[model samples]
Target: MSGQLEKIRGLKYIGVVELASQAARILAEIGTTQDRGTVSEMPDERTLRYYLAEGLLSPATEKQGTASVFGYLHLLQLLVVKKLQSEHLPIRKIKELVDGRTERELERLLGLDAKAGAKNEALSYLEKLLTSPSASSPRSQQFNSPAADMMRPVAPAHAARQSAPQQQGQATWARVEIEPGLELHVRGDYAPPTETKGVRRLTRLLLNALEGYRGNMRK
Candidate 1:
């Protein structure tokens, strides 16, 4: 794994941090140490290669080495992809969903916060939070089912509403579609993500909240 990692780090790229070797080691450790949870197996080097080939993991940063180096964003992406895989999501589908999206976008899709800095700490934080007991809700479990069921495009506005936490004394006007037969009214000046960056951040917030909702549903 280390050798393969070293080789990849030798690739040329611009603006890449010089932490290629360290990033590779951290990734390897994560691969080896992740708990199975509901997942069958963790991804290995071969899997990483396939992801790289499929354009799922893009590491285009500057470094002094002969190869391109990866940065915190890349590390976060690897962690997200691995977690989704553990949910038994097929690589083909995962690739399809995330292929064109940037790491910043994927981070938002996974509902990660913007507090992303520090490669190792950020990666560890995401892994710990996503793999904790709360991550095992019915929604996450659904990822273990057939890929066809998990491929629906999420409705942003509705999803944003569904995943938000209700709080008292929040004054704003909001419209929410409850179901085919029912719609609800709320008073709050709630707005969904409209900007490119806002959309990603909103998506991440929704996903995290939705996971909690699913867990609650199972109780």
Candidate 2:
């Protein structure tokens, strides 16, 4: 029992060290104020400070000389904040959206890939945040609303199609029924059963419709 407990503690320590190493690497490569500003498109120094003050960004892990050194998590937060603001989402709302998440959890939510474009990934990440249960703000337009609840997934009608193969036709737009009425049509010749459109537009439509319908309900 003591051996098992010691092993668990050692593994936890190793995980923390691994995270610290990755954060350090991220900082060493692109942790400068100018670099962060350029990458995130948030050039104003005061704006970064405001985000820090508002608890939108986690504090630096360590300091180098005079300036504070930020980590990969901080970089991720900055990118997400910048992208949300470009969409005209309020700062307070953005803060509300990201609060109470661990660094690793936030990374998972953002779907952060070192190879992917930061802005595009951030935009993609925002959709997931809106749908997430953590978005508990009453002002949150989607998720938990009555109209949002009304839209449900349609189940398969039959168990299987045990019939002869049908003749193939010229490829047309690939369609995906995200909900009963909502769909995403992408112009492509993708093979059958392959994912045609991802959750991008489907997520947007659901969120927009929820907000739109909710406003109408109030009036």
Candidate 3:
């Protein structure tokens, strides 16, 4: 139902030039550049490939590749970050600008906000690509299922903890159900169970897992 979901479902083959143009336009609209430049300056094929390897532009996988005009998007984000830095916008403020706007709306702002939008879009697109049927194989699907299945024991763990006496000077543990069949056993040595900190730690762990998964997928 989201615009990103729609794009992922409906996207077909788009030319490299067309992709570049679209990315450029979005960046320009978001105010990534003060001069309102076009995508003409985007790197050529070889340079773009290098950029992708460097993680400047996220590399497209086979199934959801779509000819990869990500270089333009990356460049736009960099330009916007630079512009925002020059304007003395704090990181939080810049993040707020990006978080508050849709991709199209951010494009209209044309600065740090636009850069934020670009980064968000790139990440979204990457997720779609990674999750698409074409990007994953049967084995990967199986691996993912086990990871999901790990959550089943969490409810019992929570129930057991409820009946147990709280121990002093012992690490506290929480069982979190991330999704159906996926649960995390979060252990912390600090006093006062701050759910926020647990969630942050879990999120970081998941991100690290995803990064490794992506790397393995690439290989």
Candidate 4:
């Protein structure tokens, strides 16, 4: 484990200030700051703290004197989250995907992103989509595409299909009926979850809610 982390620690241990600056620079290279990917702003120290609170980023792995220190793995975690944000992935789901991944896995995800292009390009295109709006990613408004975001596969799902949408490109989309009346509309290009996995998760969540509701009623 120590050796693996050591490999992920390309920038070594760094304080918040340096981490923030370097992360910002990387986000720029990946196009997260673009008009399409569109991250609101570069993350500052305060934002880093927020990420810590939210479980989006890992805790500091080391310390430099009185200061907390983070590693490249942390940076990659942030980048992965930012990339998924472009696909409009929810924070909870993003956490499931980013939280436990290895550095090599995270790097592979970054490399797989259409914007990022390939493995060797590594950091090149990661931040692009993070900054730009989803507009640049051609989509069908409401259809399915190959699971390319394939970076993080959504658990699984199976539900009745409920809509038809125009084609935009290879973008993926989904319509999930959470309950009889409530459903989700996933835009294509979102690297949509397959019906089996997507619906399974949504169904599980609904069941959990219903269980609690029933408990309340019994009271």
Best by lDDT: 4
lDDT of 3 by residue, 66-133 (tens): 45433333434433434454466765555444432443443334423344665766677678656654
The C-alpha lDDT values of all candidates are 0.51, 0.48, 0.45, 0.61
> Model 4, stretches more than 4 Å misplaced?
1-9, 36-38, 112-219
Better of 2 and 3 by lDDT: 2
Q: Is candidate 1 or candidate 4 better by TM-score?
A: 4
TM-score quality measure for candidate 3 = 0.30
What TM-score do all the candidates reach, one by one?
A: 0.34, 0.32, 0.30, 0.47
lDDT (Cα) of model 4? 0.61
| Weakest 10 consecutive residues of candidate 1 by summed lDDT | 145-154
Error of 3 at 114 (Å): 13
> Model 2: clashing residue pairs?
none
Give the alpha carbon lDDT tens digit for every residue of 1-219 in model 4. 224334446675466777777777777655656575555557788877787888788878688898888888888888787777777888888877786688777866666434445644444445543333332355631122222223332323211112223434433455544322344556423443468989889778867986696569646
| TM match of model 4 to true structure | 0.47
lDDT of 1 by residue, 131-151 (tens): 543243557644332221223
Native-vs-model 2 lDDT?
Answer: 0.48
Per-residue lDDT for 138-197 in model 2, tens only?
565243333332342111111111132232232233344443234555322232332536
